[model samples]
Target: MSYLSQITSPTLLIDEKICRANIKRMSDKAARHDMKLVPHWKTAQSHIIGDWAKEYGIKEVTASSIKMAEYLCGQGWDNIHIAFPFNTLEIPKLNELAKTQSLSVQVINPVTAQKLVDGLTEKVGFFIEIDAGYGRTGVHVSDFGLIEEILLTAKKSDKLYFKGFYLHAGHSYYMPDIPALYEQTRDALGMLKAKYQSEYPELVTRTGDTPGCAVMEDFGDIDEMGPGNFVFFDLMQANLGGCEKSEIAVALAVPVVDINRDRGEILVHGGGVHLAKDVLVDENGNKNFGEIVYLNEYGWTIPDHEDRSYLKSISQEHGIVKASKSLLNSVQIGDLLGVLPVHSCMTADCMGAYLSLDGKWIDHAEGCH
Candidate 1:
């Protein structure tokens, strides 16, 4: 039987060829700009894929949580940076990992830096997370006093050493125009570098958003890139011009459960639980859960505009596909349909693992219940 027939329910299919290509493309871009490509492992979260990255000369990596850091460290990753804000509760775990690996964590305030200084028993690197208009985390770029306070606290500690600055321009994801997004990202990084470069010439400035890292040709004065989503580009990244449709490496393979000719919809056994609830709004203001495609020997083929279909809505276990009459008639019950996810990161997290086209099961960190 084909790989599609072997999958009984909602399954994530990873195309190894395309995935490796995406990794090389981003790695090359970082090299061209003379920046370190510390690709975030939170997207793939698999030791197998991590090895693939090492083949491209990637020595350092970034992760979102302490658990993920510990998992990757066990896989022999020596240089790991926990990109999330430093958690005081995980200080013991951080210290333990520091004894074995070159561990690093982000600190946003002086109090957090001081806590790490007091609690850490082993030496570890620290990055001052800067809020580059994302407002999600990190200290504001204009707040030099706060940044200095954190740096001072780290400087006073023998175990905690201030490394550099890190920022994620998440707003770039919403900007579909590549030029506009590139300018916004370049200006943000340039502004930060100009204000701090002279004082701390050795400190590195790191940027970690997929859209900027993928689409922008210039990285200004940023010294490192930490993009994670480029490992598996999704429909959302394609829509935002970060990548082409053919570059998407992973898709949800769902078995068709029902066909509705009257309503021109096809129901599948996959839903929000498998693909996550992330949605992309089109130019017509219609919400799309994902884009539809047909599986083939190599991978899958995205239909043309007129023949295109979309996942209109999804419940816990059911996904509604909106397509044309001819497209709806192309498949019957039990057929496996492919869905290009809106957000590959969230979708990969939901699935917790991947099944390659060659019939190998790739394991990852388990999803949260």
Candidate 2:
């Protein structure tokens, strides 16, 4: 049977071949730059797909939360790092999970550091989170006093081991000049690593933004690259020039429900609930929920630029596709149309599981043990 015969609802379709290729590309990039590719599992949160990464020698993985770390540990990952700021309340859970695997957590404040020191039974490594310019979390790069305070607080307990610094530099996702953003981050991290490497001789630096990790060839002082979204490049990454549209490994297979030729639009059964609410504003100042692609026997292909169609608007369970004349004529009601998501990470989390092109059901983190 064809792959489409297994589809009944809006499903996330993963092209495993394309996904493996993207993995190999990133793995090769890490080898060339002499950095460890500790990919974040927040994107394709599937142990089945995670096996593909292991084929490329990625033994260590990054998780977005303690819960994610626990899930990864159950999958037999020996070394896992939780990239989110340390949540002291989850210390009991963290301690339990750390006993089975080499676990690391991100700490932005001394208070959390002390909590870890007081509560941690099993020794766990801590990365001082640095806010180079992202302003989301992490201590400011120039706040040497705060940095020292956090480090000193953590050092009070033998249970807490310092594991250098972590920076996400999230602005690279929207910033037009990635090289400039990366340079500023490199300098800030380089300075921090230089100042403290003598104290902690085994110190390492890690960067976690997909845009910077995907595009930049030169990783100055960064010892580890922890990007998640590059595994399934979304519409946002393609717009930001991180990857070509063809490299997007996952697409939403939404069944067409309506054809509105009068308004030159088509409607699908996919919306915020399945695609997430992440939207990208195009160069023409229009909001785009997802970009449309067509499915075939092998997988899917990006539509011709001259006849591009995209999900211009999305509600809770409905998607409105702004279609060109050629796009409008291409499909009918009840047909399955592929959509490249705005954010692959969020979309994958929302969809919960995947239907690979080879007709296998892949389990993801959502709703899994």
Residue-by-residue lDDT tens digits, candidate 1, 83-158: 9998898998888888888899999999889899899999999888878567789898779899888878887889
In angstroms, the error of model 2 at 98 is 1.1
lDDT of each: 0.86, 0.90
| Candidate 1 structure lDDT | 0.86
Candidate 1 shows a clash count of 0
Number of the top lDDT candidate? 2
Residue-wise C-alpha lDDT for candidate 2, range 192-219, written one tens digit per residue:
9999999999999999899899889878
* Runs in model 2 lying further than 4 Å from the true structure: 367-369
Against the correct fold, how does model 2 do in TM-score? 0.97
Name the best candidate (by TM-score).
2
Q: Count of backbone clashes for each model?
A: 0, 0
* Candidate 2 global CA lDDT score: 0.90
